[model samples]
Target chain A: MAIEVRIPTILRTYTDGAKAVEGNGATLDALFADLDARHPGIRARLVDAGELRRFVNVYLNDEDVRFLDGINTALGDNDNVTILPAVAGGSV
Target chain B: MKYDTPLEAVGNTPLVGLPRLSAAIPGNLGSDGHGAGAVRLWAKLEDRNPTGSIKDRPALHMIERAEADGRLTPGCTILEPTSGNTGISLAMAAKLKGYRMVCVMPENTSEERRELLRMWGAEVIPSPAAGGSNTAVRVAKELAAEHPDWVMLYQYGNPDNAGAHYATTGPEILADLPTVTHFVAGLGTTGTLMGVGRYLREKVPGVTIVAAEPRYDDLVYGLRNLDEGFVPELYDASVLSTRFSVGSADAVRGTRDLLQQEGIFAGVSTGAILHAALGVGRKAAKAGERADIVFVVADGGWKYLSTGIYTAATTEDAVEALQGQLWA
Candidate 1:
């Protein structure tokens, strides 16, 4: 299954500055492993200690993955994954 | 409708049904042929508040709580970090309460927002656009440290912020629509989501709380390493069932859809909430489940009038015109 993952600007150095990249995995943990296989050391930035980094947010089709099973969230073909840094919100 | 003070009228906004928009969503044909128990959309018209925004509830509640506890006294200066609405609400309340108000806002916010703050006699300090509200919060904290006399009502961490929503907004929605299955709102300081989400979760069985977070351009995260992004202290992920990051273009499109389809003119952040609400509505419809989705219209679009998003001929042109600027 192919899933397109959107990369944040800070992590672009791993994807050669590509805004998005395609990888295959049934779950987020496996997807990151797949991404690291091709991108080299990118998984370490997103995951550590067998969990997602505190500052790194991974969303599957815009819905936060943390609520949906975290790294174990299921993935499917044509799923759009987005990675972003944790930022404070104040749209009041 | 009679109140001794404007602050007394901070909440109790009307909840109106969006029959047209709800009927527009595609659902299973087999569900109650008349569309009964299918799906419905309800909008909490928070723009009708005294300050024309939902933030008035928290701003007033926070200030009053402080005043009642003696943390805020006569001749005290109030401080906060806001995008616009909260500052404007606080400024108005402070002016009426005889307290000086100062706001640290992002430089990227609209000019109209600045004018509104100034109109209410609030001093505006513009933080760098690099990190948006994150920068504003940092700057506000620094300023508060320099002047120990200034009372920063720090919305992000203050429990009173969420308390306002829990005490008023949540009860109002439950009273107005007992059948509400989902609650959606913009995720900012996470006050609204936290307070209302907690209240509804306790009162309603199997209620879903959804968050629509604004996804800004890279400039909002400018030069910050991956570890630098900040999360609100009040944010409890357990309070939210799911969260969707809505980009500016989608936000604008959602705003236009509300205006065109439902005739509700709301701020860009509210647009993000509506977009997420509709997304959930679509999924529920596909599942042939009954749903009453209520989303907050945080404020009117007047503050963002200069953005030309509402009058633009097309959503693409509107979004293109919105580029490089923070809409939410």
Candidate 2:
């Protein structure tokens, strides 16, 4: 099964400027692990050493994994994972 | 240990229940009978500070923390990064406390902010506008590394920024609206949300916390991707019950509506919170659910007078042009 991992614009530099990448796995952990193998520094940035970054969010098919089972959250075939780096900017 | 001026007491801002704003959304959008009286929303109006912005809270807290730890001394120079408010507030506070201040900021910040900072005697180092606050953060970090004696508050990573809210703003909210069901704020340095959100969650177990964020990848038009990424270290996404992105146009329109309907004049970020609050209110109402949406008015509208967000539009073309630059 192919899982699509979406890369946010800020982390594109770590992904060879790729917006989305395909991974072979039925589970999120497997998919992320495989993706991390391909991009050495990505897991560190997105997932930290073992825990996810406090500000980074991984949504599987538009549903947050945190509300589900976190790293164990199941991912179906053709599922899309979006990475969002939370920030806001404006005058005063 | 007596303070010289009363402005030093600016950190403890009040959090009041916004019956008007909350009723307008929940009462009108309620689906179930329970929604008529269940959720309570409070607004932690940071605009009440002397500088007309919440930045005064963190600005003063950071200075006090540094002074307590012997990291800063009287008459020493202060260095930090800001989009605008933090620098301006720090400029005012440092002037009052008798500290020399230098701030690294984006070049395209509003003239009002720049002039106010200058008026408070701050030396401004302009960063690349395209780089946004990240560049300012980077410059501040570099400056701190370069200077050994100068005190840099480092608001981006400084726990003191969030601590101020945790100690003062959060307690104020909990005290004013003990029944607060939801807390909403812009996820800026994450300090505001983290500080207040953490406090509210601890004080009120079932409190729903939400954050309004700009689209992390693109500009307001849903075009032009943003590559520069910056998230404050203090922000923990897990604490937020819901997070949504608000476009600049919607934020601007919300600010306009807030002034026209509620008589609450706030900054652009507050407009984002209001828009988010309305969305959350409607969702809860549509489901026959009741919830309170507490949002923060980060600052007053005095700094945005040049943008004309609160006035009548002379032309559609001119309004569109101004809208584009208002948040730019």
TM-score against native, each model? 0.97, 0.76
| TM-score, A chain, model 1 | 0.96
- Docking class for model 2 is incorrect
State the DockQ, from 0 to 1, for candidate 1. 0.72
- The alpha-carbon deviation from the true structure for residue B98 of candidate 2, after best TM-score superposition, in angstroms, is 1.1
Positional deviation of residue B107's Cα in model 1 after best superposition, in angstroms = 0.4
Please provide, for model 1 over B1-328, each residue's C-alpha lDDT reduced to its tens digit, 9 standing for 90 to 100. 7999778888999998877678888762333443434788889999999989999999999999999999999999999999898999999999999999999999988999999999999999999998888889899999999999999999999999999999999999999999999999999899999999999999999999999998887777666677777889999998899999999888999899899988999888888888999999999998878888999999989988898999999999888777766676
True contacts kept of 1: 0.70
In candidate 1 the C-alpha lDDT for residue A13 amounts to: 91
List the pairs of residues colliding in candidate 1. none
TM-score of 1: 0.97
Q: Please state the error at residue B209 of candidate 2 in Å.
A: 1.5
Tens digits of per-residue lDDT, candidate 2, A18-84, equal 8898886656677778887888767777676565676677777655577666777787888888776
Model 1 interface RMSD, one decimal = 1.3
Candidate 2 residue runs with Cα over 4 Å from true position: A1-92, B1-4, B11-20, B26-40, B216-228, B312-328
Q: List the residue pairs that clash in candidate 2.
A: B39-B292
